[model samples]
Target: MIKGKGYLKFSKSKNKIYVYLFGRLTGEEKKKNLFAFGRLENALENMYQIRESDRLPAELSELGFNFDDLDEWILALETRTTRNNKKINLPVIEERCFEDVTNYDLLGMSEKEVKSLNKDETFKMYSDLLEMIFGALAHIEELEEIEEG
Candidate 1:
């Protein structure tokens, strides 16, 4: 029942879904898993395209998630609740936006060009730019606090 904007690896065992975020299993106790994508469109396309036929077990077909909306699936996971009052462990969407912006190529553009392109009229580009700005700001604040301490 994991959702959000990135790649997720999952499997169903004993009527439960075991989700892995950013290539690491849930048992690892990692706080966050970074995704590399320039825009939310790219991220959503990758996330929603996952079908139950991909990696799910035969028993999971009866679960509601097989036909549920992506957002609903995410919500269910976040609350750790199933439709039938069962508890399920799932991956969390640490951040709705991609984390590793540098990992994506801006179509062979230079740094300056990339910055300029971010000002384009496309809504997707603007959204990505905003997310990147906030993420950078948070990182800077964390670094400053670490240095001060």
Candidate 2:
């Protein structure tokens, strides 16, 4: 298990990955039962919308915390989480030579906006975002250096 942020864990084969609040909302500093928002995106989004006292820190990273930009990191996080949760794999041309992939909009994007995007546009967006994540992870060990230094 890859641990982060108190008791949060990410596994190479993690299924039903959740984001939970750990730590204190009250003035006391004892353990509190975790409140899971079911998914990281839901937790992060709601954590921002709700009072800070209602939750603990929900940063994108816990170890080292070397994020440069929150928004970019969030997009990368969402892309990674969504793809992982969906188990997205490289499209095999023969597997879909005669079938059409289902059309679906992003979870929170407005339907009108999604409707304006064609399959190519959606795929391009996914490709670019995922590439950004891969690039970022390539330098992930830098955060460890920051921590040790």
All models: lDDT? Answer: 0.39, 0.40
Best by lDDT: 2
Among residues 3 or more apart in sequence or in different chains, the pairs in candidate 1 whose N, CA or C atoms overlap within 3 Å are: none
For residue 142, model 2's alpha carbon misses the true position, in angstroms, by 1.9
Candidate 2 Cα errors over 4 Å, as ranges:
1-89, 92-111
Which candidate number has the best TM-score?
2
Cα lDDT tens digits for candidate 2, 1-149: 11232333232113223444344433455655344444532544554334324433454233222232233334334454431355323221221211232343332345555556665666555455446555554456457568889
Q: Count clashing residue pairs in model 1.
A: 0
Clashing pairs in 2: none
- In TM-score terms, candidate 1 sits at 0.22
lDDT of 1 at 102: 68
Instruction: Evaluate model 2: give its lDDT.
Output: 0.40
Candidate 1 overall Cα lDDT vs. reference? 0.39
